[model samples]
Target chain A: MLIALLWYLGAVIFTWALGLFLLWRIEKSGVKRWGATGRLFTYK
Target chain B: MQWYIGAMALYAAFLIWTNVKSLKMAESASDFTAGGHRMGLLLGTGTTTATWVSVASVLGIPAFLYSDGAAAIIGWMAGWIFGGALIPIVGYKIRRPANPARTFPEFVRMRYDMFARRSFLQALIGVVMFIGYLFLVNIQATGFGIVFSSITGVDYKVAIFGFLIFIVITNVGGFWSVATTDTLNAAVIAIGCIAAAVTVLLSTGGLGNILDTLAVTTAPINEGGPALDPGVLLTPTGSFGSAALLSIFISNSLGTPSSPHWVARMLAPMNVKVAVLQIMANVVVLLVIWLPLIVMGLGAKALIPSLPEGVATDYVIPLLLQEHTPVLVAALTLVAICAAAVSTGNSMLLTCSTSLYYDVYLNLFGRTVSDRALKNWLRFIVFVVAVIAVVLAIDPLWFLAMGFTYVYGGFGATFSLTVFLGLYWKRMNRAGAYASIIVGFVAFIIATAADVPVPFVVAVSASAVACLIAVYATKPPPLESYEPFFEAEISESTKVAVERVLKLNPAQQSEAVEVRSV
Candidate 1:
C-alpha cells in the first residue's frame, strides 16, 4: 500500500515538474521557433 | 430540498448574469468566436482551466477513484495532466501568427489546403469536428442531468432540458461570455474542492488512517462497484497492468494537444507569451483541484464502505455528502460540480457550432456572409447545437470518465499525428492528413468496438505509419502551405500570400476569385 501510495504521490509531483519543465523548454528554445520575447512578467 | 432549490437558483442566476454581460461585449463575429484574439492572462487561464476540467474532473475522476481505486490516478489524473503539459509545445506554433484562425478547422484549412480547389480536408475536418464536439457535450449534459436529478429529486430527462436554458444563454454571448462565466466556474471549483478535501480530512482523521482502513477493508466501494481486493486499492495501477497504464496514458497525453477544443483555447490568447503563461496557470490550478479529489475519494471509501444497493460509484460523492456532511457542504459541492459540467458543455457547444458555421457553412459551402450577419446567425447555430446535445444526453451513460475517455481517445487517435506532423514537418500535405484521419479513426473505432486494451496507442501508431507513407508518396506540399509554421520569419511574398488567405473566407481560398464578398 505504501509503495502504491508513493507511486501516486510521485506521479503528482512528476506531473508538476514535467509540466513546468516543458514550459521552460518552450521559453528556452529561443525566439526563432516560438517567438517568446522573454516578457512573461510584463504584458503588452 | 429548499436549500437545493435556492443554491441551484443562485448559481444559475450568477452564470446567466455573467453571460449577459458578454452579450454587449461581443459585437463582432471574431469577438464572439475568439474573444477577438486579445484574451488576457487571468481570463485565458480561467476559461481554459474551467473548460478543460469538465464533468470528467468534477465527477468522473472522483467516481473512478471511488470505484476503480488507484489505477485512475495514472489512467486519468496523471495521463490528463501529461496531455496538458504538451499545450505550450502546440501553443507556440498556433499562436505564432498575429491573425490566427478562431476555430481549429479553419486553421486546418489555412495550414493544410490553402490553395486547393474545394478541399476535401476542410470538409472532412468540419464534419469530424461537429461529431467530435458532440461527444463532449453529450458527456457533460449526461453528467449534469444525473447530478441535478439526484440532489433536487427532478426527473432525469426533465432536469436535462431545464439545464439547456443555461447552456444557450451562456453560449449565446459567444467567447467572451463563456470565458467570463467559466472564470467564475473555475473559482467555485477551486473553493468547493478544497472544502471537500477539508471535510474528508476531518472525517477520516488523515491520509494514513484512510489508507490503513483500505488495507484492511475488503468490502465493495458500493453495492454496484467492483468488489475490493484488500491489496488492490493501494496499488499504482490497481487492476491495470503496466502496459495497460502506459497505453492509456499515451492515448490521453498525446491526443489532447491536437484536439479542436484545446487548439482553439491556445489560439484564444493574445500572444504566445499569454498563451504560454495561461497554460502554466491551468496546470497549477488543475493540480490544486485534483489533489483534493484524491483525498476525498479515498476518505469516502474509508468512511462509507458500502452505499445502498443499485447505486453506482458515479454517485459516491453525492451520497458521501448527503450521509456524512452538513447541508451547505453538500449543496456547494453539487453546485460546484454542476458548474464544471455546464462550463464544459457550453464550451463544446460553442465549438460544435463553430464547426458548422465557420468551417462547414462559410468555408465548405462557400456562403457569402457578412461579418455583421455572421455575428447574429452564430447565436442561432449555438441554440440548435445545444438542443441536439440535450437530446443525446437524455439517457445518461453509466461511467462518466469512461465516456470522456472514449471521445478523447478517438480525437487523439485521429488528430494527434496529423496535427503534430502538420506543424513540424515540411513534407506534410493533404494526402498525409487525410490518411492519418481516415486510417487512425477507422483503427480507433475498430479497437474501441473490440474493447482493445490499448486502442489509442495502436490507432495512433497506425496513423503515424500511414501519414509518413502517404506524405512521401504524394508531391511535396507548396511553400505557401508550410511557410507560416516552419519559417521563423516568413518570406515577404509568402506573408502577402498568407495574409491574403487569412483575409478571404476559407471557402474562397481554394481557387482564384475576383469577387470578394466576405
Candidate 2:
C-alpha cells in the first residue's frame, strides 16, 4: 500500500514537472508558434 | 447537525450580503457581467480559483481514488496543469483589444456570422450546457443533503430545501454577488480541505496502521490484471496502468481548457499575465487539495473495503469522514464538503443565469424590454435557474455525473474552438463558426443520449471532428466582412494597464491590434 501510495504521489509530481519542463523546452526552442492558434499567448 | 447547519447558514448569509453589495456597485450590464472590467488582481484570482474548484476536486477526486485506485487521482489532477498551462497564452490575446464581446457565444457570433451567432445551433448548445450545469448543481445540492443527513438525521428533502434557500439570496445580486461569495467560499475550502486531511490521517492511526490494514484486506488490484500486486504502480500498464494515466492526461488537457467556468475565469482576471497567474493558482490549489484526498482515500480503502456501487464515488470521502473521524473533526470536514459543492454550484448557477439573461433573453427580448425591465429580467432569470436546480436536486435521477461532463466538454469544445481558431486562422469564416456550433451541439446531444462504452472519448472525438468540419466547410468571408471585429474598444490611455500584465509582449500587442483592426 505504501509503495502504491508513493507511486501515485510520484506520478502526480512527475507529471507536474513534465508539464512545466515541456512548457520551458517549447519556449526555449522558440516553438511558441505551435500553441493554440489565433489567440494571444504565443504557444499556440 | 448543529455545527454544520449553523455554520453553513451563516456563511451563506454572509455570501449573499457580499454579493448584494457588489450588485449595488454595478452600474451597467457590462459591469454586471464583467465586474466593471476593473477587478483587482487579488479578487480576480480569488474568484477564478473559487469557481474552478468545483465538485470535481472536492468530492469527485476522492471518490475516484476509492474506486480506481491511485491512478484516478493522476487523471483528475492532470487537467488542472494542462488547463492552467494553456490559458496564459489564450489570455494574453483576448485581454488586449477589450472588445465588447461578453460571452464565448458572442465571440463565436462575431468570428462567424449572425446565422451562427443567433442561430438555433448556438442556443441549443447553451441549452445542453445549462442542463448539464443544472444537473451538476443539483448533485451539489444532493451533497448538502448527504452532509446534513449524516449529522442531523434529517430527511434529504429538508436539506435540499435549506440549501436552495441559502443559494437563492445571491440570484438577486447576480454576477457581482457570485464573485464576492465565491472568493469567500474558496478561502473556506482551502482551510477545510487541509484540516480534514490532517484529522483523517490521525484518525486512521497513521501510515503504519494504514499499511498493516491494507496488507490484510486490500482487494485484488484486478480480476485478471495481476492480483494484489502493489508493483502495479511500477508498470505503466499494470493494475491502473499507463492507459488510465494517459486517459487522465487527455481528458484534463483537452477538456478543462474548454470549460465555461474556466473561460469565465479567464474573463475575470485583470490582465493576461494575471490570468496566467490564475492558472498557476489552480495548480497550487490542486496540490493542496489532492494530496490529502489521496491519503484519505487510501485510508478509506484500508478501513472500509466496501462502498456501495453506482453512488457517485466522490461521496466516499465525506462518508469516510463522517463515520471514521471524531465528531469535531467530522463537522469541519462536512463544512469543507458543503463548501466544495456550493462553490461549484454558485459559480455554475451564476454563469448559467448570466448566459440566459445576457446571451439569450437579452439577445431575443431586450429589444422589447426597457432598461429597468431588463434588470428585473436578469434577477428573474437567476431565480428561475436556482428554483429549477432546487427541484431537480430533490428529484431522484435528476442528476447524473456523466451528463455534466458531456455538456461541459461539448459546449467548451464548440465555443473555445471558435475563439482559438478565429484569433489565428484569418480564414476561419462566419460560415464555419455557424457550422461548428450546430455540429458541435448536435454531436453532443447524440453522445449524451447514446450509451456508448466510452462516452467521454466518443463525445470529445465527435465534437472535434464537428469543429473541423465547420471550419473547413465554409469559405472564408472577404476581409471587409471581418473588419469591424478587429477594432479595439479600450482607450489608448489604458495601454499602461495592459503593459502591467507581464506575460504579454509587443508581438502579442499586435494581436490585440489586429482584433481592433478587424
Best by lDDT: 1
The best candidate in terms of TM-score = 1
The residue ranges of model 2 lying beyond 4 angstroms of the native Cα positions read A1-44, B114-125, B207-216, B219-249, B308-312, B366-372, B395-404, B444-473, B478-518
Which residue pairs clash in candidate 1?
Answer: none
Docking class of 2: incorrect
lDDT for B200 in candidate 1 is: 85
Give candidate 1's total backbone clashes.
Answer: 0
Q: State the C-alpha RMSD over the true interface residues for candidate 1, after superposing those residues.
A: 3.8
- Interface RMSDs of all predictions? 3.8, 8.0
Q: TM-scores, in order shown?
A: 0.92, 0.78
**Worst window of 10 by summed lDDT in candidate 1 chain B:** B509-518
Per-candidate alpha-carbon RMSD to the true structure? 4.0, 7.8
Q: Tens digit of lDDT per residue, candidate 1, span B323-348?
A: 77778887888888888988998888
Evaluated against the true structure, the overall lDDT of model 2 is 0.57
Per residue, candidate 2 scores C-alpha lDDT tens digits across B114-156 of 3322334345445555765677677777766666666677777
